[model samples]
Target: MSTQPPSAPVAEPPPAGWEEARSRVYAVGLAAALPSTPRPLAEADGHTLAEPLTTRTDLPAFPTSSVDGWAVRGEQPWRVVGRVLAGSTPAPLTSDGTTVEIATGAMVPEGTTAIVRIEHSARDPEGLVTGVPRPRPEWRLPGEEARAGEELVASGTPVDPALIGLAASCGQDTLQVRRPPRAALLVFGDELLTSGPPADGRVRDSLGPSVPSWLRRYGCQVRAADVVGPVADTLPAHVAALRSALGTADLVCTTGGTMHGPVDHLHPALEALGADHVVNTVAVRPGFPMLLARVTSDDGRVRFVAGLPGNPQSAVVALVSLVAPLLAGLQGRQLPVLPQVTLAEPVPGRGDYTHLALVRLDRATGTAYPVRHVGSAMLRGLAGADGFAVIPPGTSGSVGDRVRVVPLPLLPGERTW
Candidate 1:
C-alpha cells in the first residue's frame, strides 16, 4: 500500500523593501483613520488637529504694550494722564503731550505715537514724562501675529503644549482633533516568564511591559488592562486572543510567532480569521520577519495587526520602522520624517538587506556612534541608544557620511533640539 506524505508548507512571498513596507502599512492606516471630535484644550494634547486652527479675532485684538512703558501721543515729555493694566481698557490719548502708564501686555491707548520704556523714562515733579523712543515700535499692533480668521496651524498637525497655548491665544476654547487610536498588545510565546530572570531556557518578557509605553509615545491609548501576554503557543489560543483584542482595539500588536516554525501559530491563526496581508516581511536586518495585516471584524470594522520579532532589540526596530508611521497615518498626521546625522564611525552594511544600527547621538556635534551590545536579543544597547542609523541596502556607512536616523520618541518632560 502506497502512503502519501504530508503536503509541503506553502512558501511566503519575497520580503518587501524596508521603505516599501513602511509606506504600505501607512497607506492602510490612513485609509482607516479614526473620526474627528471636539476636545477641550486640556484634553487635546497628543491628538491630531482635524481642521486648520483659525484665529477667531486678530492676534492681540488691540494694540498691546510690549513692556511696562508710557504710551505717549504726539511727542515725548508728555503729561501722564492715566494708567492701563492687563485686562483693562484705558481712555484714548486724545490730547497731544498726553501719556498713559501701560503695563506689559496691556492694550495701548488709541492715537498713541510711541511707547517709552519705564526704565528709560524720567518723571518730573509735575508728573510729566521724558524719554527717547527706540527705533523699533515698543508695542505690538493688532493682527501683528495673525489676522482675524487666518489659519495659524494646518490640519493633521499633532497637538502639543505649544500648540495648545497657541490655540488658546487664538480664542479657541476647544479644538477639533482626531481621537487617539486605541491599541492592544498580545505577546505570544510559551517560554516567556512574566516576573523573573531567564531560567531553564525561558526568558523574561520585556515587550509586554515596555511596548505599552512606546505606544503611548505615539499617541496610542494603550491601557494596562489592554496588554495580554504569554499566550499558549497553540493555533486556538492565538486565534482567541487576537479576536478578543481586535474586538475593541483599532490596532493589535503581537510579539513573536511570526515565522513558520513548528510552534509558531500566528500565520495560521491570521489565515483562519481571513486577514489580508499588507506586509509579510521587510528587508531590514535584525527585524526582517516583521509583518502587518488588515483584519475586518464581524461588525464590519477594520483593524490592524502588527507582528513584531521575538528578539528584544529587533522588536524595537520593527516598532520604529512600521508602527510609528502607521500610528501617524491613523491619526491623520503627516508621514514621519527621518532626521540626518553624520556618522562618527564606519558601519558595515548587510549586502542586500537594509542595516539599522543602534547608535548614540552626540547632539553637540550632530554625530552618530555605534553602541555596544546591540545584538538582536539584547536590550542593553537599546537602552543607551538615541536612535538607529539607517544604512541603505548595498551601501556601507562611512565615517562622516550623512545618513538618515530614526529617532526614538522622547519620554515625558524630555526635550530635543
Candidate 2:
C-alpha cells in the first residue's frame, strides 16, 4: 500500500455548499489562450476563426439556370436554337425568337427573360423545341444568396467541415483561426501511480489520462502530463514548481489538491505565487470544490491554474466548469452551446445551487431524464451519460420543466447521430 508521511496532517472538511465554492473560483480567473494562424482548410474543423472571411465570387458567380429548361427571350416563347452547359459561358442571348436549352446550374445567356422546362417544349426529330414556351420568371439573378465580396463567415466562428466547404465555395483555401492553447497537467496525490494494478490502498492515476482528452476537445494542446506524487509538502516549493511549469505553459491544471486537507497544500502554494481564486466553487453539484486561480508573478505575467477534486467525476466536472471556459477565453472563442430540453421529473428541491444530474436527452422526443449511478464518486454515471441536466441555482420546477444541459465532451471516433 502507498504510505503517507508520519507528519502528514488531516484536511479540513469541504465547504458546506456549492455556491460558496463557485463564487470563489470565478472571482479569480484569467482568459484562455486563442489559436493563431490560418489552418489549411483541410484541417480547420473545431477551430475558431480569427478573421472574417469575405466571398471572392457571388454564390452563383453569374446568372444561372435554376432548372433544366430552355432560356428564352422576353415575353415571347421561342424555338430552341442552342444548348448551354454549366461550364460554358456562351455569348449573351440576342435573338428574340430563339431559345438556348440550359441544364440545371448552367449559366443563362444574356437577354434571356425566362426559363421554360424541356417538358413544356414541342420537340422535333432533331432534338430541338419547335413550339412556343410557357411563360415564367427569368433565370435566377446573381448574388441572390451572397453578393460578391460579402462576408461569408464572421470572425470567432467555429469552423467545421461544412464551414470549410463554405470557405472553399467562397474561393478560400485557408482560414485564420485562434491557436490552441498549450497546457501542462499535474496530477498530485500520494496514492497515485502512472501505471500498475492498484494495490489495496492505492488508486491508479486517472486525471493524467482523462484530462488530455478534455484538453483536446477544447482545442488545447497538452504539452506535458506530469504525475507529481504527494511528495510536495511546502507552499514555497510547490509554488516554484508550478511557476516553472507555467513559464512554458499557457495553462496549468492540478488535480487532487483543491480541498483543504492537511496534506493539500495547493491553495497556500497558489497564494505564495500571487495567485487568487477566480471561482472557489460553483453552485453546481458534483463539482463543488472546483477552484480557478489566476497566478501573476510580481512583474505582471499571468498564468491560469485550475484545481480539481480528486474524484474522477468531480475532476471531470471541474474541467468542464473551470478549464473549459479558460481555454475558450484564451483562444478568444465562445463557449460551446448548451442544448435545451424539457425535464421529465422535478429535481428534489429548489435552492441556490445548480444541480448537475447525469441525464439522457432523447433527440426524438426532446425529453430529458436523469440517469442512474450519479453520485460524485460514481464513474459509471459519467460513462453512460450523454450529458447533464443543469437545474439552475434557486429554481424549482415540476416534471416537464425546461432545463438546459451542457453536452459532455465527446469521445474520439464516436459516430455522431
Best lDDT among the predictions, by candidate number: 1
Tens digit of lDDT per residue, candidate 2, span 281-362? 5657777777777877676666788888888888888877677667767766555566788888666543666777777877
Deviation from truth (RMSD, Å), model 2: 6.3
lDDT of 2: 0.72
Cα lDDT for residue 371, candidate 2: 78
Writing each residue's lDDT as its tens digit, candidate 1 over 1-417 gives: 759988999787999999898898888888988889999999999889999999999998998999998999987679988899999988888999999899999988888989999899999998889998898999988898999999999999989899999999999999999998999999999999999678999889999999999999888999888999889999999999999999889999999998999989998999998999999989999899999989986777889999999998989999998999998889998887888999999999999999999999999999999999999999999999998999999999999999999899876346563
Model 1 Cα RMSD, 1 decimal: 2.1
- The per-residue C-alpha lDDT of model 2 at residue 345 equals 69
What's model 1's overall lDDT? 0.92
The CA lDDT of each predicted structure is: 0.92, 0.72
Task: Report lDDT (Cα) of residue 4, candidate 2.
Answer: 66
